[model samples]
Target: MTDQPSTDRLSEARAALATAMALHEQGDLEGAEAGYRAVLALEYRATDVLPLLAGLLGRLSRAEDALIAWEQLLAIAPDHAVALHEKGLTLHWLGRTGEAVAALEQACALDPHNAIAIGNLAVVLADAGRNHAAIGQFRRALALQSDNLHLRHQLRRLGAASVPFWHIPMMNDAPRNDAFEAAITAAIAVAGPDARVLDIGAGSGLLSLIAARAGAQHVVACEMEPLIAEMAQQIVAQNGYADRITVHAKPSTDLAVGVELDVPAQILVSEILSSDLLTEKVLDTFEDAHRRLLAPDALVIPRAATAMGCLVASETLADYAFVGEVSGFDLSPFTDFAQQRLPIHGTMTAWQRLSDDHELVRLDLTQAKHDAVLTRLRIPVTASGRAIGIVQWMHIDLWPGVTFDNHPDRYTDGGWLQILHSFPTPVDVIAGETLDIAVGHDRITLILLPLTQ
Candidate 1:
């Protein structure tokens, strides 16, 4: 008699599960959920009913309930790939990025051939700001599903968005490229054909290739951006220099002398100088390279760099630097939060010089360490109205005679632009008067402050 009752209960559970599935197909999620729970209460196919209940809860936007259902399913079937993937998606939707990445990564490992899981994992990774890892995952998913348009679009978007826009133009910059190549050849000639060269910030492996072609026996290049580093490796191979050059996806600080390089590098080539000359952490990077990765006297490219600028007054630029009455309302207080630096294409912008070019600051890369600098500069104003700011550019001394500068008057169509370091407030000045200002660097930024006399 007891056996007969157990049989009756099993029949009842099976009927309930059938009814729940019908309700789910009919779009009655609540009814389906109730039926699935009743089936689980009977302990009949709980593993099967748990997934149904969890998916229904997710559809109902009950994420917490859905998570509980998924955890229960996982407890029953620990290796359930689908359950893990769904749980990861839920966690991502709930803004639990770290946990989501962990879960999806696990799912991808369990079901390596599952394209959906891989793509979803890539999405979660990108959300976590792991762009290069995300790109790698996306590429893997795309390789599995070659005709997937969404996957292709994602790769293209990441390539365009994550990288700075100036990289392409910078590569196309013939004059700049020539100057760097000239310096690289000169350094290689001095260091000899067997020189071990280290190129920091190797975008597209251009400089590494230059060193290899210039007869350097070995070249190790490092780029912090993983996506860019991957491309650099590919480009180096495509150009038939893979045997001579190796690119690492890491910052210069992460590279070591014995591991990335066989020994201390004889030449250290880097083009990390920002338009303002210090914003790229050039001083810190170079100092670290010198102390850890380079020989006693490494040949540094662009041995010294200078920040050159002149005082400027422009009605168009004044509007950018300060705000007064806007639409008949006094918004002058907002001027207190004006932009400190504005990048402008010098030839394209209309601005008049109020003073001759002045050397704002200079950085010697060979130095092992640097301290914050502050100096008082007396400027002899020649033509002045309302001085808005200083228009700054770069002058790079590559070797003894080879140099490059993006001067406002001559350098056009290059990747770099003149940076306007705006004053705190517009200062009215007269021609033939001297303006005293503080000009220097805080190791990472060019400090230009107009002083009151």
Candidate 2:
């Protein structure tokens, strides 16, 4: 380290570097790049000159050449934080996602406290579709640079890309929260203070905190998203319940009975139902919990969930589900590729119910096993129009005498929104006709479509 020449110790190299920097600042990029290369070839301050040359190359859209310059600098100093960080950015520009992530990850490791480096790593990870890891890195960067709006914007943009926009509003739903709190309080009451509780999908640690506040001593919670899990841990600790609740950054299926938990939990409280009720993988997570992470008789919150819906007709929703007769052409076949399901504010959106609400699908969470269910249900039409699809919502049986639903009729302004399951093509129906529809789930998604027969 002492043998390393400081800028003041290198008279000739420092003068050359000054001239190169002047050329760079004066927008003589070509001249600057060549000067930097000439200095590096002289065995001058390569560490200094390489950065300029690499950055100039990148600016000139020579990302591959910039990458080479960065690699050369890295060879001389493998742990150089700037080299790794710039190399990562260059790799990202070149669409080398894997290499970008590797470089950025190494940069973050070398300069753990550098928020910019961490943020760059997060960006690369997100582009690579490793969203969970990317979120964690952005959160870490945000923690370091709290007032950075750009970082905050990136976090929100990436978050929206990864999660549903309703999550924030859903967390703000006092009715939904109260239902879970009451159920959790009751579950803890039945299981006793010492009963261990497992909260799968502990987003914001709300359920776990409710369990802790209800006097449950040991609560183990797992969230698949690393960033949310970390935030949950922080929120739990901030509220002084860290001692009672442990948050694990993993999916419940990855949890081992004695490893991540001191034994199978006695009570399971999870709020993971999607609008359609299965897209969040609640069935898979809960079944795994029952098999490996929960006590044989563990009380499950939301013991059951049902997808309830009715036939609907709406031009507003129809526009979203179908497109045809654009200006003056028949492109009706494109409807085959239209979105199958769409989420909308049921009360806010104009829709006419053609039939009374019917049960579409139900899941018994208390049961340890579940298979894909497909059944033919008949919807007796009461009003007739162009039947776009079924507008569906959820009815969650949280506990005895405590239930919640985002019923499309009276329920408005909550985290939940009614989802429209569009048909392959709009079907015209008349009153007093029963629409035979295939209504069930394929284990992971709800099956709601009108049957041709």
Per-residue lDDT of 205-308 in model 1, one digit per residue for the tens? 99999999999989999999888999999999999999999999999999987798899999999999888888889999999998999999899997999999
Best candidate per TM-score, number? Answer: 1
Best by lDDT: 1
Q: TM-score for model 2? A: 0.85
Q: After superposing candidate 2, which stretches have Cα over 4 Å from the reference?
A: 1-55, 73-85, 101-122, 129-163
Error of 1 at 234 (Å): 1.6
| lDDT measured at residue 213 in model 1 versus the true structure, 0 to 100 | 91
TM-score per model over all chains? 0.94, 0.85
Query: After superposing candidate 1, which stretches have Cα over 4 Å from the reference?
Result: 1-5
Candidate 2's residue-wise lDDT over 92-144, tens digit each? 99898998888888988999999999988888888888887787889999999
- lDDT of all predictions, in order shown? 0.91, 0.88
